[model samples]
Target: MADIIIKNVYVLTMDSYELTQGVVVIENGTITEVAESTEQDADQIIDAKGSVVMPGFVNTHTHAAMTLFRGYADDIPLDEWLKNYIWPAEEHLTDEDAYIGTKLACLEMIKSGTTSFADMYIHMNDVAQAVKDSGMRAALSYGLIDLGENRSADVELSKGKQFVLDWKGEAEGRIITMYGPHAPYTCSEGFLSKVKKEANHDRVGIHIHVLETESELNQMKQQYGMCSINLLDRLGFLGPDVLAAHCVWLSDDDIEILRGRGVHVSHNPVSNMKLASGVAPVPRMLDRGVNVSLGTDGCASNNNNLDMFEEMKTAALLHKVESLDPTVLPARQVLEMATTSGARALGIKSGVLREGYNADVIIVDMNKPHLTPVYDIHSHLVYSASGSDVSTTIVDGRILMQDYEVVCMDEQDVLDRARTAASGLVERAKF
Candidate 1:
């Protein structure tokens, strides 16, 4: 019952084709028409000034509220980071802190041109509420870690079940819930088999970490007598609905297993490289017909900022250098990993800018210094544009950000709350 006309834009339109520019009409949170619209009654008009309009970025896996822990632990091995710094800090988090931290993360994500993301963490009720308030689309999962005795496992399972019943598919259907069993090392075979049963019955998807480190690969091999992927495969864990993050240590057989099972992989290039997790064999995954998407992992590991542009650039160049082939993961394919492929990975219907797709869109300001002399817009977008270059963001036909200001959130208030939360958490964490 409403119309917003975005005009005079270089519209990237991440449709089936590569780069195409045209007008888009958004009505009631769904794109009614894109390009060559004959009807022109508009309620809202945004002059893009030839800025690129593309599908909003889909962050395939992240811990949104972990922004509070950014730089709290760094330059450490994955096991050390988890056991020494991150887990200790996480134990001190309150629901209020999660709310504030997720708000800050959502603000940063929108500003950086991400409309939708998949998140895995604890206190997901706070995270989901924050997503609803910020008007961002997300798939949230309560991470189930049964590291303690059997009692601890029961507690985790209870919390995860409650999260599924309470918050799944909330926020006007902008949010979907998933089951997260942390990873292989923390969860036992019996626990994971139970998780698979829960997933099957609940008919919900799963978001999990997979082969993120050489340690993980080694542990699975030594402890389980199988590769990590094979262990999951034996448990029937990989599916079309399964989204596995950071396949940095996957082998050729592992890639085949994932492809055969239709498992979606999220390539967190920055986070992996930062953790020295090694290259993910992204080109090999692509060659094997895997649905490879993009993600920032978490601000803690990625440093800060949720800019998919930087992630895309890293994904593109990292593969080429790792494979020693210039033709590996070109700009266009890297762009797909952030947009449509990302959507596909998350099992969402709105990756491309077209009719019937959800109105998830971002408008970039092309007048910036780095984006000038626009020879190829896609290349420039992947290689040059930063998160700050995004001028406006629209998700579900509602303008969440315009002229670099977020409409659905108060950035200053979030900043204050997060600062307070961080100080308190540090004190309570005994750090």
Candidate 2:
């Protein structure tokens, strides 16, 4: 008998630029078949009942451990937000706190139909372990911010090597590790070069914040005498494997540099807008052939929910409002950025529905009023459907969320931990 069969679903394969009605067969932790004719039997079957079954979203940028600090310090410039509140609070974050925070992040991700994410955070082993326990797929980065002399870059690099050694391919290959050099302003050239050296050996990708603020842009221009993207390019930062977050305030030459190097950009509109950071030149970047993906950045800035659908809508509309062109970043491209493009950025396999791919899928309740009279599934997904409409989330052929309920973890317990952690973080912040 087949392992799992999903029947009567409107499958938006996200493959070959099309969507259709079909049944999917999953077995051995991989998608075994996709056929319109549900003329088969299985050990288990889900009657999707006309829901939109599509690939699970991939969050290419997130500070998973920072979910503990969500809404603790909002309504500030990006620089001040980091320096005044976030950095100070992060100092007090222990491994237990990271575990607790990341567990909450994973739960939120599951509830919102995100199956995979690229996460940068401290106490990363805790975050990685949380992913392991939750059965969520993630790329865990040990956020290397060595501003203090006592705790140097060497220490962070050593810890990164240890992460690679210990957890690189763990959790049945669900967890991957990356070298995170927080941002250009936070990392010196010498330090980032060392990170590159380590990353080259490991052949893993590097995650960095690029031009999230005008001040950061000015700082890079004055200090390095180069634009942030060009500075990174000079430092050997851009490549096939690099995933740069934010990327606001980019110049034409910067877009050219990214496109030339085939660097992937993680567009986080929610975080950018929340911090009053200006919109990145996404249209220009796309025109220059840059691989752009969508991310929630983190719960602290976006505030508790890593829904790629919302991100997509924000991205599609943000440009129109700024550029005064409604034609920019249409629904089709937005969905691709969230799904297939995001998977490309993180080097994961299953962004589309097909045989032999990892079974990372989500079923959206298309029967809802918001999604009714679906002219185009892509349009409905991007412009209408909310994260709550996601009825099921499956990763590696394992059903994590089913019928609007998370199956693997206690949802209430996860919420309680987050509530406690948030209160504790606030208490400790009163200094």
Candidate 3:
């Protein structure tokens, strides 16, 4: 007997082009079968007659707790936004703030069909705890910075290392920890090297922001006479294990270096556009055989929400207009970036709806008027579909949201607490 079976649905396995009507069987937190018909009995069976069953999205990069800062500070340059507003406001965020904020983020993601994400931020224990309670998978890290005289490099690294060791494989293997060395401009070479060494020793990955803006690129050139990519490559920090977010200022040489180093790039088109940061060379990188994934950077200040569907649509449209080629980033490819490429970046087995893979799946309702007359599934999914179209979300064979009703956590409580926390933070920050 299977644990759960979803029948009479258009199954998009995402491993190939074939989208067929089939039944998916889930058991033991893994996909057991995907076929035209199943004779298996299950504990709970969903008759999704007018839905598309596909892999849940993986957000490769985000600051989850930054949900509290949504709309707090906007319309400012990246440096000014961070220094004058975001950084100052962050000092007032407490553990409860982080927990409630992350809980709110998890609630939003679950409703929007994202099963997992990679988050780098402060108050990560509270963040991890929130993830655990939300029943979502995550690659989490404590954001590390070592530039200012008041901050000790050793202490930051020690805290990061302890968090990695303490939470790795926790929450029934839903939580994967990494070393987050904030960014190139903020951390010195020696600190990045140390982080790389420690991450290698612990056999975990490194998540860092790389060249999100021209300002960072210029700063690196002024300080080290090289670009951020070259500097990090010299430090031996670029590799397959490195999930570098926002490679917006890359030249051709920098792209080649990233490709050669096997670094996975998280293209945060929404955040970059919101910040007025330059666009990344996603088309060039994909052509060079580099793995590019999708991400909606923190909601509070940049993206304003963790909607992978919006990110997918924005990515498809943004690359098309920027390159002046309508054929650049098509709907299907952008969908892959949000799914398989994202899972590949985080080294998770939850992107494809296949046998022996993690059962992180979502059911998108196609019965709506907007989604009707779907001649092409990919076109409608990428161009017309929104997060509100997701009717069901499942992670690890467990249902988080079924028919728009969230069961893992209390929706109203999370929203209320999040509002209260945001209010208190504003009062404290006085910005």
Candidate 4:
């Protein structure tokens, strides 16, 4: 018998095509059957009532604990924001603070239909605990920033390696771990090399920022005599196991290197625009066969939420304007970035609602005014649907939210603790 059965839903399998009246059977955290109809019984059943059912979203990159700083600092340049506000405030963050903040982030993500995410942040053990308590799947990493200091590099590397040893493949395989070197500008070549060596030794992936701004590119050129992508390539950091966020300043050569190395790109369209970062040549990267996934960066920079649906819409619209071609970044492609491409980036098997895939799925209420008269399901999903429309979120065959209510954690308690934590963090930061 299946563990759960979801029947009579408008399903976007995200594998090849859509099914108007589909039924899914999940057992042992894996999809057992997906078809137009199923006669089998299950321990639990969810009558979707014509709701739209699809694979749960995979957030390829984010600073999950920064949910505390969502609106604390905004309307500033990325460099200034980090130098003046974000970093200093982060210095005052404690493990408890991270736990509370991450709880809030998980709640928000669950409500918005995110089942899995890749998070780079400080105090990641606490973040992992939050993920466990909230029943969310995540790829966790400790943000390693050397800042050109040998001692800092040593300590950061030790912490990062220890984190991987402690938590990689933990939480019933719901949590994956990676090594996160903050960026080329923040970490030196030697430090990144050390991280790369350790990541290879452990057989895990590396997550790093690459060329997110013109200033960052210029600084990398002046210091390393090459663009950030080539510099990393020379350091042997480009590979299939690397997830590079923000290629907003890449040249054609950079795109070629990424494609050749089989590196994945996590494109944060909303955050990039908010920070005035240049538009990444996503169409060109796609043409080169680069797997470009979608993300909403730290909530501090994104200024309020972790909504992949909004990211999809903004990504589609942004590329159209950037290339001055209406044919760029179609709705279907953006949706793929949010689902299948994101799963591929994280090296997971949960993005498609198909047999044998992980049972991570979501149900979006289509009985709304905005979702009415859906001429095309994909078109409406990309151009009209909002995160608020999600009625259920499931990860690893467990329902975290159902009927718009989070079931894993106490929603009110998380919000209350988040408010308290954010207030205390701001006060401690003296900002």
Total clashing pairs in model 2: 0
- The reply for model 3, stretches above 4 Å from the true place, is 148-151
| Global fold similarity of model 4 (TM-score) | 0.99
Q: Between 2 and 3, whose TM-score is larger?
A: 3
Number of the candidate with higher lDDT, 2 or 4:
4
Give the best candidate by lDDT.
3
| Residue pairs in candidate 4 whose N, alpha carbon or C atoms collide under 3 angstroms | none
Cα deviation in Å at residue 245, candidate 2?
0.5
| Candidate 2 backbone collisions, by pair | none
C-alpha TM-score for every candidate: 0.97, 0.97, 0.99, 0.99
Which ranking of candidates, highest lDDT first? 3, 4, 1, 2
Candidate 1: which stretches are off by over 4 Å?
18-21
Output the lDDT of residue 156, model 2: 78
Q: How many residue-pair clashes does candidate 1 contain?
A: 0
Taking all chains together, the TM-score of candidate 1 against the true structure is 0.97
Q: For every candidate structure, what is the RMSD over all alpha carbons to the true structure, in angstroms?
A: 1.3, 1.5, 1.0, 0.8
Cα lDDT, all candidates? 0.88, 0.87, 0.94, 0.93
Candidate 1, 179-213: lDDT as tens digits: 98898878888788788888888888888899999
Model 2 agreement with the true structure over 166-285: per-residue lDDT tens digits: 888899999988888888888888888888888999888899888999988998899989878888888887898789999998989888889999999999999889989888999999
| Between candidates 1 and 3, the lDDT winner | 3
